[model samples]
Target: MRKVILLFAVSMALSAGVRSAEELSVDLMQSIEDTNKSLSSNIALSNKQAATADAKELTQMFAQVETFFDHKGDAKNAVDLARQSKELSTDIVGFVAVNNFESATTAATTLSRTCRTCHTFYKKE
Candidate 1:
C-alpha cells in the first residue's frame, strides 16, 4: 500500500507540473497582450512613466518565459530569442524614459518579431 501511494503521489505531481506548463503559455501570451496595449496607449498619450512601467513589466514576463523554457530543457533553442526579447523590452523602456516614442515603437516591433520567432518553434496549438 505504501508503495502504491508513493507511486500515485509521484504521478499526481507530474500531472500537476504538466498542467502548469500548459497554462504558462497562455499566461505568457496574455502578458504580452497587456504589454502591447499599455505600450500603445501610453505612447499615444505621450505618457512616459506608464510606458516605462509597461516595458519593465514586459521584461519581467519575458524573463519568466525564459525560465520556463529552461525548465523544459528547450533553452538551447530559445535562449537567444528570449534574450533579444528581454533586451528589446529594456530598450523600449529606455526610449520611453527619454520620451522617444518613435524609437520605442521600433524597439517594440523588434520585440514582437523576436517573440514570434520563438513561438514558431515552441508554441503548440
Candidate 2:
C-alpha cells in the first residue's frame, strides 16, 4: 500500500510538470500570433492615403508588439528577436511620421523577415 501511494504521487507530479511546459509553449505561440497580427495591420496602414490613418494604426500596432515583451520570462533569445522586430517597427513609425512612404515600406519588409526568423527558431511544430 505504501509503495502504490508513492508511485501515484510521483505520476501526478510528472504529469503536472509536463502540463506546465505545454502551457509555456502555448503562451509563446499566442504571443507570436499577436505579433503577426500587428505586423499585418501596420503593413496595411502603410498603404493608406491619409498620413493620420497610417500614424494611428502604426502607433497602435507597435504598442501591441511592445506589450508582448512586458513581463516575459527569461527567454533571452526570444526577447532579442522581439527587440529587433520592435526596432524595425520604430523606424517604420518614424518614417511614416515624416511622410517617407518608401523608407517605411522598406522597414516594414525587414520587420516581416525578423518576425519569420523568430517564429522559425522559437515556435514548435
- Best candidate according to TM-score: 1
TM-score of candidate 2 relative to the true fold: 0.52
lDDT for each of the candidates? 0.81, 0.61
Model 1 regions more than 4 Å off: 1-9, 18-25
What is the per-residue lDDT of model 2 for residues 1-73, given as tens digits with 9 covering 90 to 100? 9999999999999999877643444554565556556655655566444533443454454454445544455
* Residue 27 lDDT in candidate 1: 63
Instruction: Please give, for residues 11-70, the per-residue lDDT of candidate 1 as tens digits.
Output: 999999888875567867887888877787787788998888898888888788778777
Please count the clashing residue pairs in each candidate, in the order shown. 0, 0
Q: Which ranges in model 2 have alpha carbons more than 4 Å from their true place?
A: 1-74
Each model's TM-score, in the order given?
A: 0.81, 0.52
lDDT of 2: 0.61
